[model samples]
Target chain A: MTDWTIDSLVTALRTRRISAVEITDDCLARIDRLNPAMRTFITVDADGARRAAKERDSDLAAGRALGPLHGVPMAWKDLCAAPGLPTSCGTRTRDYFVSEMPCTAVARLVAEGAITLGKTNMTELALGPFGDNAHHGHVQNPWRSGHCSGGSSSGSGSAIAAGLALGALGSDTGGSIRLPAACCGIVGLKPTYGRVSRAGAMALSWSNDHLGPMTRTVRDAALMLGIMAGWDAADATTSRRPVPDYLQGIDRGIRGLRVGVPSNYYFDEVDAEVVTAVREAARQLGTLGARVSEVRVPDPVPLGEATGVISRAESVTIHERLLRERPQELQPVVRTRLEFGEHIAAHQYLQALRGRGRLTQEFLRAVFSQVDLLIAPTIPEPAPEIANVTTGGIDEIIKKMGRFSRLTRPFNGLGLPALSLPCGFSTRGLPLALSIVGRPFDEATVLRAGHAYEQAAGWVNRRPAIG
Target chain B: MNPSSTDPGVTAELTRLSDIIERLSRGLGLADEPASFVTVLEEGAPGDD
Candidate 1:
C-alpha cells in the first residue's frame, strides 16, 4: 500500500483490496510518524479526511458514478485557499485568516472526488526559493532530513515525497512547484500561463504566476492537470481554448520527435553532477529514437531580468497595502525582497512587458522550429543545507536561489508549458530532475516526452524512507 | 486655457512631488534619517533655472 502509485491506488480501491477508510488511515498514520520531523504540513485535518473517505466508501457501495480522482487523497500548498483552513500565505500577518471559500483548483479537485488531506507549508508569501519560513517551521526534504525542500511549495513536495499524501497542488511563480519537486524527486508540471485558472490562489505575480500539479509520476500529473485545467470566467487571462486529454496520449512514445538542447546560459555554472544526470537523460532520449539537436536560447539573462522586473512590479502592487500597513509582519528577507519592487520604474516595467512578447516570439521560432520539446536541467544544483543560506545578503541569496529557476522563469515569461521529472539522484543523494518544455499550449507533447522518459528511467519507483 | 499658462502650477506640483518622493524613498528602505532623505530629494529633484 505504501508503494502504490496513483494508478495502482485507484485500481486497488476499485477492487476493494483496500478500503478508502484504510487508505486514509494509512496516510494519516504515515503523516503522524513522519510529519513531526519533516514539518511538511502546516495543517492536517485528520477527522475531515476520514469522514470524506467514509462518504466516498458509501458512495462506492451505493453504485454511484465516480469522478476521475474518486477516493484519492490529496493535499494543496498553503497558498491555496481552502474553506475553514487558514490560508496563511506563509506569513504572520494572515495567521488568523481563514479563507471564506476554496480556491477554484481546490474546489475542482475536491469535486473530482479527491479527499483533501491538508495544506502543506511554503515560503513566506511564496517569494523565496528555499523553503524555510519563520511563520511555519522549515519544511525538510524527505530524501535527506537536513536539506531544504526547495520553495515555496516546499511542503507539497515534501509531503508527496514522504507519502503523507498521494498527490498535491502547487503554485509556480518562477519554479516554485518544479524546484521543490526536483529537490524531493517527484513530478511537477508548471502549466502554461492561464492553462490552469488562478482564481482563488494567492497572487504573487499576475504575469509570471502559474498553478499546476505535483505528483509521483508524469501520468499522475497528467490526470491532475486534466481535472485542474480549463477556462474560468473569474480569471479573464484563462484561455478559452480546449483542454486536451493529457492521459489519452500516455502511450505515445518520443519516436520521431525533435528534442532541442540549449547550448548556452542554461549549462553555464551548473553543478557537474546535475550536468551528468541531464546528459544521461538526453542520451536515454536519443536511444528512444528522439532526434536530439543543439538549439540556442536567447541569452537567458535578459529574459530573466525582464521576468524579474515584471514579477517584482506586480508583486509589489499586490502586496502594497500589506507592505505599508504591516511591513514587520513579513519575514525580514521576504520584506526586503518585496521592497525592491518599489524601485521598478513604470517605464521599465512597460519595457519589460514589450521585451517579453519579442523574446517569446524569438524563443518559439528558434526552439520549436527545430524541435517538439526543449530539455534542460530543472535546477543547477542539489538542495543545499538550510543553515548555509543567508537571506540578509539579498543579491547573493537571489543568485544562488535563483539558479534553480533560471531555465524555468523564461518559459513563464513566454507562457509556455514545462514539466520537471526526476531523472536521477545527485552525488549528495538528493534528487536531480530535468525539465521538458514545450511550445505554448502544447502540454500534450511535454507530457508525452516526460512519460516516455519515466518509462525508460523508472526513477519514480524510488521513494523516500519515511516510515 | 493655454498649457503654458499652467507653468506656476507645474512648479508647485514639482515641490509636492519632491516631498512625496522623499517620503516614499524612506518607505522603500533608501534612508531613515531626515538629512539623508533631504539629500536624496535634492539630487533627484528637477533643477530650477
Candidate 2:
C-alpha cells in the first residue's frame, strides 16, 4: 500500500473505502519488512496498533463522530513520550526506559484520533545530522541504499519516505526535522520555537528545540500542525497566541507575496545541484506571482555560532546527571559533545541567550523587513554516503555535521518557522529541498508558499522506489 | 572541564561564544536585554507586526 497523505487517508477512511485496520496492518507489515533494512523504527507496537485501529472501526460503525485524525496511523520520533512505550531518544542510556508521562505533542495528535504505530529511530540524544547512531544504527536514505537519511529525526524521515507510516512527529533542535525531511524526500516543518508544546518530548536543547511534523505532503503537514500547535501548561514556553487554521491558509497561493532569495550566506559554497534546484524553485514561485528577489542576509556565521552555543549549553544542562552517572552508556560523540558543553562559561552561554533577541531583531530588520518569506536550500548538498559521514574522527565528524546543519541552524536561533519541501532530486537520485522561512508565529505563510511551490513543482508526491 | 572540551572542534565553539560576547558588547544592549530565553521564542516584538 502506498503512503496516504493524511488528507487522502481521512477521506478514504470516512467513506469506508479503506478500513483503519487494513491501513494499520499494511503499514505494520511494511515496517516489519523495512525496519531491518533501513532501521527506521526502534519498536513497532503491532498488537497495540491493531487494537487501536479496531476501536476506530467500531467507533465509525457506532455512528460516532470522530476527530480529524481518526484512525490515522502515524509514528512519533523516539524523542516523544507515548504512554507504555520507551522513549529511547536514540541512545543506549534510555533504550529500555519507558515513560508514563504524556507528551503534549503526541497527545494532541492522538486526541485527534491519530493512532501511534511506534517510535521511529533517531541519533543519540537527538544529536548528529548524518542519521548515525552507535546504538540504533543509521537510518539509511529511503531513495537509495547506504546514503544518509538526514537526522536526528532520521527514522521519522526514512519511515515516512518509505511509507511505513503516514506521517511522523519530528523534533528539531538545530536541523533535525528539516534535514531528515530533505534527505528522505518528504516535507518537514520546524515551527516557531514556541508554536508547539514540547512538554513530554526529549529536550536536547531547552532553548533551540522545536517539535514539528514530518509528512509526505505539505497539506498533511498543515493539518498535523493545526492539530498540535498551541499553548500547553505542561510547557511554560508555549505561546498563548491563537493557532491559525494552517490548511485554510495553505492554498492561499503566494500571489503578490514578497519572497526573498538570499544573495549571501545560504547560497555560499552550496552544492551546484542544490543551488540550481532551489533557484529553480524560487523561479517557479515567481511564476506563481510571488515577487521573488535577492535580499542580503546578515552574515549567518555569528547566528549559527550563537545557535550552537545555546544548543550545546542547554544539552549539557539536560544531561548533567547522566554524564555524571552513566556516561559510558551514551554514544561517544554525544557524550563527547555534552562533555565539551560543560566548559562553556556561564557568561558566554548567557551572552548567546540574551543576544538572541537583539540578533533576531537585527535579522528581521535587515532581511524580513523586505520580504514576507525567504526561500533557501534546506541543505547545502544532497545526502552523502552513510560511511562517508559516520566513520570520521570526532573533530572531523563535528565539522561534517556543521556543514549539514549550517543553513537550518540560523533559523533555530531566530525562532522562525521554516518548512523544507522537496524541490528536486540530485543526479545521484538523492533529494534536495527548498526552505520557506517566515516571521515568528507565521507558520501559515510558510506552509502557504511551500504548498504553492509543491503543487507547481509536482515533486513531493513522486515517492521513493524503496518498498 | 571534561578533557573532551579541549578538542579543537569543541574549542572552536567556545571561541564563537567569545565572538558573540564581543559582538553583543558593541552597543547591542545585551545587558538590559532579558535572556528572552525559550518562552519568548514566539513573539518577535509587540510592534513587530
Candidate 3:
C-alpha cells in the first residue's frame, strides 16, 4: 500500500480492497522511520492524516466518495500553505505561522479528497538548487546516502522516491520541481507559469514562480494537474483558459509527434553520461514512432540572463522585510542571493521583463515551428555527493548553483511548460532525467512525449534503494 | 490552452519598432501573442475542464 500510486490506491480503495486508514498508516510508518534519516518531512501530522483517512472510510461506508484522489495519501512541499500545518518554506522566517487558509492549490487537492501526511522540507526560501537547507536540515538523496536530493522542492522528491508519499505538490521557479524530480527518479511537471494558482504559496519571484505536481508516474502527474490547474479568482495571473483532461490524450502515443533533439545549447557542456542517456531517450521516443530529428533551439543564454534579472528583482521584493530585519537569520547563500537584487536597476528589471515576451516569441517561432516538443537533459549531471556541494565556499556555491540550474532557467523566463522524468541511471546508480519542453500551455504534449518515452524506456519501475 | 502563457503585459508593447519588425519577419504576428497577463483573464475560455 505504501508503494502504490494515486491511481492504484484509488482503485483499491473504491473496490474495498484497501482502507484509507491502512494506506495512511503505511505512509506514516514509513515517514516516521525515514524522516530522521532522510529529512524529507519538516512536519508530520500523523493524527490529522489518520483522521482524514477515517473520515474518508466513513464516507465510503455511507456511500459517499470524495473526488479524484479520495483515500490517496500525499505530501506537499512546504512552500504551499496548508491549514492547521505550518508551511516552513524551509526557512526560519514565518516557519511557525500557520495560515487560516490553505493555498488554493492545496485546497483544490483537499477538495478532491487527497489526504496529506504533512509538509515536506524544501530549500530555505525555496531558493537553492541543492536540497541542502541550513534551517530544516538537508534532504538526502533516497537513491544513495550523502548525495544531493536536488531542490528547492527537495523533500517532496525524496519522499516520493522513498515511498513516503504517493505524490506531492512542488513549486518551480527555475528548476525546483524538475531538478528534484530528476535527482530522485520520478516525474515532475512545471506547468506553464500561471497554469496553477499561487494564491497562498510563498512567493519567490512572482513572475518566475510556477506550481505543479511531483509524482511517481506520468499519469499520476496528469491526475494531479487535472485537479490543480484552473482559473482562480484568487490569483489574477492564472489563465482564463479551461484546463484540459491531461490523461485523456496521454496514452494516445507519439506516433507522428515531432520531437526535437537540440543540436546546440541543450547538449552543450552537459555531462557525457547525461547527454548519452537523454540521447538514448530521444532514440527510444523515435522507436515509439515520434518523428525525431536535430533542430537548433534559440540560444537560451539571453533568456537565462533575463530569468536571473527578474527573479532577483522579484525575490528581493518578496523578502524585503525579512531580509531587512532578520538579515543574520538567513543562510549565507539565501542572504547573498537576495542582496544581489538590490543592485539591479529598475530600468534593467524592466528591460528583462520586456525581453521575456520577445524571447518567448522568438523561441516559439524558431523551434516550435518544426517540432511539437524538444527533448533534453533535465540536469547537466547526475546528483553530486552531498559533501561536495555543501562544503564549497560562497563563490563556489554560486558557480554550482548557476551551472546546476542553467538548463532549466530559460523555460521559466519563457513561461513554458516543461516535464522531467526518469530516462536512465548513471554508472554510480544516480538517476538521469529527460526534459520534454513544449509550447506555452502545452503540458499535455510534454507529458505525452514523456509517457511514451518512459513506457518504452521502462525506467519508471526502478525505484531507489531507499525504503 | 491557457493563452500563450501570460506575457505579463505591463511591458506588453514592444519597446522598439525594430522588435516588432523582427517578430513579424519571424512570422509571429502581434495577434499570435496572447493579451498581457493582467488583461484577458476572463475565466472559462472555451473547452472548460
Candidate 4:
C-alpha cells in the first residue's frame, strides 16, 4: 500500500481497478498505524474523507467529467484553512482557530476531486526550520526516527515519506517546503511567488510566502501546480501570468539545456557529502545532454540577510496583536524570534525591500543569461537529529536551524521558481537533494529539467522504512 | 549567546544586522524601485492597467 504513488492511485481510480472509497480506506489505515510515531497529522478527518470518497465514486458511476486529480487523497499544511479542520499553524495560540471556509488554494484542489485527509503539523508559527514543535511533539523523520523532518511543513514531508498520503500541500515562506522534501526523499516545488493564491493561508512573511505542492514525484508536483496555479481575485498578488500545461512539456527532456552551477555562496559551507552528491547529480544531467557549467553568483550573504530582516519584521507585524495579548502561549524560541523583529528599524526594512528588486533582476540577468536552470544542493547538509537541535544553546540552535535555510531563502527574496528533489543519500542513509531553479513564471522548464534529472539519477524510487 | 540571554543582548544583535543591511543598500541606487507591491501589478509596469 505504501508503494502507491499519486499517479498510480489516479490511474487505478480512473480505470476502475480500485474504488475511491477503497483507496481512501487504505490511506486511513496507514495513517492510523504510522501517525502515532510520525505525528505527521494534527487532525484526521476520517468521516469527512470517507464521505468525500463516496461522493467521488457516485460522480464516477454517473460518468461525469473528472478533475485532473480525481479521487486522489491528500493533506494540507496546518497553516492553511481546510473547511472542517482546525488551522493550528502548529501553535497553542491558534489551537482554537478554524476558518469559515477553505483557503482559495484548497478550494480549488477539492473542486478538482482531491480528498482532504487532514491537516499536517508544522513548526509553531512556522518560525523554525527543524520541524521541532514544543506544542505538538517534534515530527519524527520517517527515514530514521530521532532525525529531523524539515519544517515548517514538517508533517507534510513526514507523511508523504511514511506513505500516509500520496501528495500534500506545503507552504514555503522560506524553504519550508523544500527542506522537508530534501530530508524526506521526496519532490517539493516552491512555485514562483504569487503563482498560487494565499488568500486564506496563515501569513508568515506576506511578501516571501509561497504555497506549493510536496509530492513523491516531480510529475505529481507539475500536476498539482497546474490545478492550483492561476489568478485569484481574492489574492491580488497572484500573477496574471498565464498558467501552462505543466505536464505537457514535463517529459520533453532536457537535451542541450544549460544548467548553471554556482561558483560561490551555494556551496560555501556545504557538507562534503552533500557537495559530492549534488555535483554527481550535475554530472548526470550533463551526461543526459545538458551542458553543465559553473557560473558566478552574486554574494548571497547580503541577500539572505535581507530576506531574514523582511520576513521577521513582517512575521512580527502579523503576530503583534497575539504577542501583545498572549505572549505566554508561544513557544520560547518563536516568541524570542518574533520579539527580536521589533528591533529592526523601519528604514532598514524598507532598504532591504528595495535591495530585493535590484538583487532579483541582477541575478536573473547574470545567471539565466547563461543557463536555463541553476543546480545546487537544496540544503547545505543532511537533516540533523531533532534532539541535537532543540537541546542546544540558543545561539547554537539558531545556527543549526539557519544552516538548512541559508541556501534556500535567497530565492524567496527573488521570488523565482525552485524545485528540490532527492539526488542521493548520505553514508548514514539520510537523503540529500539538489535544487533546480528557473526564471520567474518558468516552472515548466524547472519541472522538465527536474523530471529529466530525476529519471536519470533514480533516487526517488527508494522508500523510507516506516515500520 | 545563551538561550536565556537578556533582551538587551538580543536587541543589540538585531540592531547590528539592521545596520549591516542599511549599509549594504545605501549605495545600490534603488531608492525609486520598491519591490514589495510589483508582483500583482502589470509585470514590471506597476502603474499600468
**Among all candidates shown, the one with the greatest DockQ:** 2
Error of 4 at A120 (Å): 0.3
Ranking by TM-score: 2, 4, 3, 1
What i-RMS does each candidate reach, in Å?
Answer: 20.1, 3.7, 13.1, 5.7
Cα shift from native, residue A158, model 3 (Å) = 0.4
lDDT of 3 by residue, A239-342 (tens): 86678899998999999988899999888899999998988888888889989999988888766776677788899988888899989998987887887776
Residue A270, model 3: lDDT of 94
Best by TM-score: 2
Fnat values, one per model, are: 0.00, 0.46, 0.01, 0.27
- lDDT value for model 2: 0.86
Per-residue lDDT for A44-116 in model 4, tens only?
9999999999999999999999998889999999988887678889987555455555688899998999999
DockQ of candidates 1 onward, in order? 0.02, 0.44, 0.05, 0.26
Error of 1 at A194 (Å): 1.2
Give the worst 10-residue stretch by lDDT in candidate 3 chain A.
Answer: A93-102
Displacement of residue A266 (Cα, Å) in model 1 is 1.0
Q: Please give the range of 10 consecutive residues that has the lowest summed lDDT in model 4 chain A.
A: A93-102
lDDT of each: 0.81, 0.86, 0.83, 0.86
TM-score of chain A of 1: 0.97
Q: Which of candidates 1 and 2 reaches a greater DockQ?
A: 2
Clash pairs of candidate 1? Answer: none
